[model samples]
Target: MLLPQVLPALVVGVAASLMFLGISFLSEEFQVVLWDDLPDALGIGRYSSLWMITMLTATGIAVGLVVWKAPGHSGPDPASEGLGGAPLAPGLVPSLLLASALGLAGGVSLGPENPIIAANIALAYWLGRKAQPSLPGAAWVALASAATIGALFGTPVAAALVLSEALSSQPGRGSLWDRIFAPLVAAGAGALTTQLLAEPSFDIGLPPLSDPGWGDLLAALVIAPAAAVFGLAACYLFPYVHTAFRRLRHPMLMLPLGGLVLGLLGALGGHLTLFKGLEETKELAASVGGWSSGELAKLAVVKLLALLVAASCGFRGGRIFPAVFIGAAFGLLAQALVPEVHPAVAVSSAVLGVLLATTRQGWISLFIGAALAASPSMLALLCVASLPAWLIVTGRPQLELDHEGKALH
Candidate 1:
């Protein structure tokens, strides 16, 4: 009896792995072309303020066109979708990609990475339906989509963990086989995609812990509660904040708002907190050795608030990257508050926010903490910090979902 179920899962895993890998390759090329040539093509930096405004307006119009003409092509964002079991429609992939690209190119506060992952999932769903028609293509699409996301994020394992936790809202009641298959496909897809894209693995290089003593342990204990509180605050406040976005009543208006906000931020800081802040966050962590305590705190606050605002205000993106940046910066600041604790230890402790908010798995945060700093010792410290926060947040619902599994107002 179980064998039949297991066989189908295995098949889904294998097929999803292949599809995700292929799409990852395509996405990589797409990213490179878009990132390298588009800015120059648009003369992004050479124009006057009016020209810049006009360009942004044009981009907004484009996004508006896509969103208006195409339904379900936008909203709520990737982390929410992954958390809420939102179904994917493959036909929406082209429109979403176009809109996401326009947003990314126009310097919106959104990240294309998550949208790309989602697009691939949508693609897989469409293909599976066209081929098998009768099979549970939705599940396979999700599995394959997850695999692509993991691979693209450079930590397919972490991707797997987050998706599994999000899908299994009942904790231990869902089909364990589904959970297993999804991640397995995601890992394979992620690895293959990463390879073809020439993207480096998720290894944010931080100095190794020289001597993680009792001081470090103490710091982790302190930071754990604080991180959980911060996460809870964001989750609780999200609905109210996101309500501003819904009020726009039109993508045209919302698109311009996204561009204006992104433009003001980009013009002020030269992309400091724009985009996903993933690469920028990693760079900041590397520069921590040279930054003063004041500088670290400032960076932490800016990134955290920017990310919160972006997510809450109808920006299209994922919180995962910004969360990493926020956690890293917060960790650095925590070290300053407690001089004895290592910065690496502080970073590990800070990564628990996302875990507390949605992804309730301890290992995912631990791996992210470790991967973000590229230090096994730091990762170990994160494991210590995230466990308690995970326990605390899991018992409570972080997000409200409607019958369709969409986020509620």
Candidate 2:
């Protein structure tokens, strides 16, 4: 019994690791070319403004071409699909991988989570169906989702938190773990594998909150809602952006146009504001002491708009990484203005707000806020902050697209 469950998870871990290998290698090479090798080869100084623009513009064009009339078209607009969706047809796998590779490496402001999830689902499903023809389709989805998420976030907890609702709703469960036991097996293996490979550290480097005061709670209440409002502004603008781009009616045109605009935004915001927020967040955190509140504000706005543009223009990936970056920048801005507030409270509250506003996952948002800020002392404060933030954005539309790839008004 245990062997059957554990063996599949081991397979998932190995497969997911293999996929990450390709993504890391290609993306690293792309970065080195734009920032290092290509600059010297072409006689231009490294990190030149021109190289930056060219890299992004070229990324947009290349991504657009791969996604245009390609075999998979990148397996559907990721904006239309949330973190999880039905698996893809086998034929779509080739194009999905290509699109995913481009999006991950080509400097798009999205992460590898969504496409990776889809790919994992297809692979796991194929294996499960062939071996265990008696199993339900939902099980395959759950298992694949768990394995991939575990691989990406370097923890099974992220997958478990994100999937709690789905698991809880299942009809015949001995316990939540019983239903998710196999996925957890896959998750543990996946997390272990990723950790061995990447050694990722998500600590956003904010000063730890040692003691929380009422002022911290109060600040959280204010900042969290403000962050949510900013997120709401983007939500309102998303449909308009998509509609405007749809006017072009062709990936060849719309995507490249978005790339140009994104490049301009990057020029406006500088290098710190580009790409998925992982490494950049660390850099921003380290430099918060030097930046003006105005600069921080610009970073936040640019990232939010960049996220909208990237998602609207058919870039395929997840928004959480970018949202985390946006929240961190906004939080840094808050701290700059009000030095009295603990960095932990300010940054966590800000993260909680934007993530709640965008994903509407209250628990996950709170967890992320606590995790990224590395402030266990401020967990209660983050919870307090998350309440009002969740209330403010509860009924509003989310940062996702509908079946027809149109944003909800």
Q: Which candidate's lDDT is highest?
A: 2
| TM-score for all models, in order of appearance | 0.77, 0.95
Encode model 2's per-residue lDDT on 1-409: one tens digit a residue: 4456777667776676657656767877777766678779989855556766777788888888988978867777666788778878867877877776776665678777777788888877877888877777777777888888787878888778877766666678477767778788777778888888777778978788788888988999999999999988888787788878888988889888888887788888888777887788889988767889999999999999998998888877788888988998898899899988777787788988999887777767877888887767778888778788888998887788797756653
* N/CA/C clash count, model 1: 2
Compared to the true structure, candidate 2 yields what TM-score? Answer: 0.95
Candidate 1 residue-wise lDDT, 61-147, digit = tens: 666677777766564443255432444665666666666665555544455556666665666566656755655765555555556
Model 2 residue runs over 4 Å out of place are: 1-3, 405-409
Highest TM-score against the true fold, candidate: 2
Error of 1 at 257 (Å): 1.7
